[model samples]
Target: MLNPLSLVSPPALRAALRDRLTFRAKLTAAFTALFFCAGAALLIFVTVLARQGTMEQFARITMDHTGGPTAPQPTSSTSLAPVSPPGPDRAASTPGPGPAASTEPWQKAEDARLARVEVNNRLQETAVRQMVVWSAVGLAVMAVLSGAMGWWLAGRALRPVRKVILAARRMSEENLHERLQLTGPQDELRELGDTYDTMLDRLERSFTSQRRFVANASHELRTPLAAQRTSIEVGLADPLPAHLIPVREDLLITNREAEHLIAALLLLARSDRGLDETEDTDLAELTRQAADELSSLAAERTVVTTVHTTPLSVNGDPVLLKHLASNLVRNAIQYNHPQGTVTVRIDDARRLTVTNTGPRIDPTRVDSLFEPFRRLDRDRTAVHGHGLGLSIVRSIATAHGGTVTAAPVPAGGLRIEVRLPTTR
Candidate 1:
């Protein structure tokens, strides 16, 4: 035989399994089932006790009574007392029939006694049957009522849990200071809420320390890099020997790339730290500005650029939002083949999509493109970028409470889509 579990689809089975894990449902089902089973047991015990009692009463009495024209009629009493035959003097006066003739009334009396006993047994059985049926019906109704009551009680008992879940959802890494300061009786639920708040307290402190460290490190790192860049520009401004000229240019290029990397790191850190404040900013205008700035780069690569946009406003940091657009367009241009096309589109829903014709990316490996410092060539010295472009785009979008997704195009290249809410 096929396993019954196999008949259920995987999704349906998962749903059922998850439902069974619900605390409220489990509590209600357990209480109802226990009550129903116990009630049935009690009912069965009473029924059997009543039946046994009736049988015992029949066993105790003789039931050897005679029936005749002058005999007393039967009654509804449980015990039937045997009657003694008429005395010898009374029999002599009555001139009763012979012994064999007397057998008729005795036989009839025995038959009548057996018949009455059978009828009483049937009546008792019927009474017991009716009692069982009605009791069962009452038990079923009570079970339903108990289930409903249990469900409500369970919900009330679990109210604190819902509060914790809501508070956890509201308190992201950026807002770890929020706490579930639940109020009510000092029960398990209250204790749980208090524990959660304590955990958040520790988390908030840790995040504050980390943010401070990042800020200090960023300042320290940028200072030297800026000085280095200035020195290179001033010291190497004059022409040099034929061989020294190439060396000077290489030094300048290396210094500039280093500064770019440091700046990218700071931007990524700021985006991950989350927006401090938000304002209404037109995404269409930002996209135009960012893409326009990269127009020269696209021309240098001989890649055609196309932009389609509509007025779209969203609430976020303007600097970060512009960078998000700039990075996307820059990556499209930088990674494309000569004569390839880059298309940027925006809509009123605060959505932006940038499609580019480039070398085909493996569908499976496309997800890794969003990781910090991941390059398709697997080299940190790749010409186009330091591999932080997509990662920074993802961080900025996340800080704005938006989503970004990329999929490889069928013909070649990638189509990246971003979705942002219209308002904060």
Candidate 2:
């Protein structure tokens, strides 16, 4: 049976709703909570005091009506009860010897005062209940107003922070010169913007230095290589001595490999710097050309090649796009089994795929194939490639706002796919 707890979203378990709230929302909540607590405390204090005072006033008025704090006492002592002087008239007026006529007048007055005090208490209690209801209504209204005010204050305070975020997000290798230039007091937000600007300045300088170095290195290294290739081709000509034939062929092959390595390196660096201009290029044509260029290698490896196209096109640097296609096709062919099949295809949606029937590849380690110098275990110690092919392909694709992914095909082989934005 599935665990009920497992049905919960992973994110829900990792972060609560309150924790996921933005900084401004959290600050507003804090403000509203504080205001509510303070207001409630003040209202409760006043309600208690008012109730006590009202009750005390009711007691004082009750005492006044009763004449004194205690019942009145007789000033002089006399007979306990009035006895009529032995007269027949007194006996005739009194019906019986009952003590009803001898009752104290103050006792009746005290009972009437207690009834008035009870009525007053009921009125006071009613007033307190009404006061409590009104207090709750007032508190609720104030809470709403407080929440609105807190939200407004939070928005105002976060205005500069939002600006800083926008400025940072827009910062890229091509636009490293841009700055926040935030003008305000030397508070934390202002300090944050300033620090961000400083970091950009350093980044701008570093990128500039890196590009300069790449350019200088490219020119310096390519000049000597070109000169060497020219010397070898001219001095060694076509027909040569049998003893020197192998040496000449070796030199030419070595020179060609060096040139290829340098070209790949330059392509990687160029792609990293991003595209300066873009033009509509048909990816189908590039895919075909890549296959044709590597036809000799495939023939030597006894690999069969097939190309299919659907007229896919994208807006990007043609040279970089061509290199990306070439690298993918070359990697597939170079890492394939003898007499294997390499198929290339591009669709109208600007998706290019290359699948090869090569040696079985570990599915889990397929992703590492795109990293520089990372190769399958079968080719790990082989000197045929330095494994920069896929890395360059990825860099170029990213420069063109494209993506590349690779997966191991079941039953031994690999499949790679590249997707680029269609031309507008």
Best by TM-score: 1
- Candidate 2 lands at a TM-score of 0.80
Compute each candidate's TM-score over C-alphas.
0.83, 0.80
Q: What is the C-alpha lDDT of each candidate?
A: 0.85, 0.84
Worst 10 residues of 2 by lDDT: 70-79
Give the per-residue lDDT digits (tens) of candidate 1, residues 108-146: 776777777787788788988999999999999999999
lDDT of 2: 0.84
* Per-residue accuracy of model 2 over 1-424 as CA lDDT, tens digit each: 9998788798886677768899998988899899889989988998899999999998888877677546456445433666558677776676654445444566677778878988998999999999999988999899889999999999999998999888877666657889888897999989988998899999989998887786668767888999999999899887888998899889988888877777777887899788988999888998899899999999998999999888976899999999998998888888887889999988665689999996678888989988877887965435477688999999888778778999888877889999888753
Q: What would you estimate as the lDDT of candidate 1?
A: 0.85
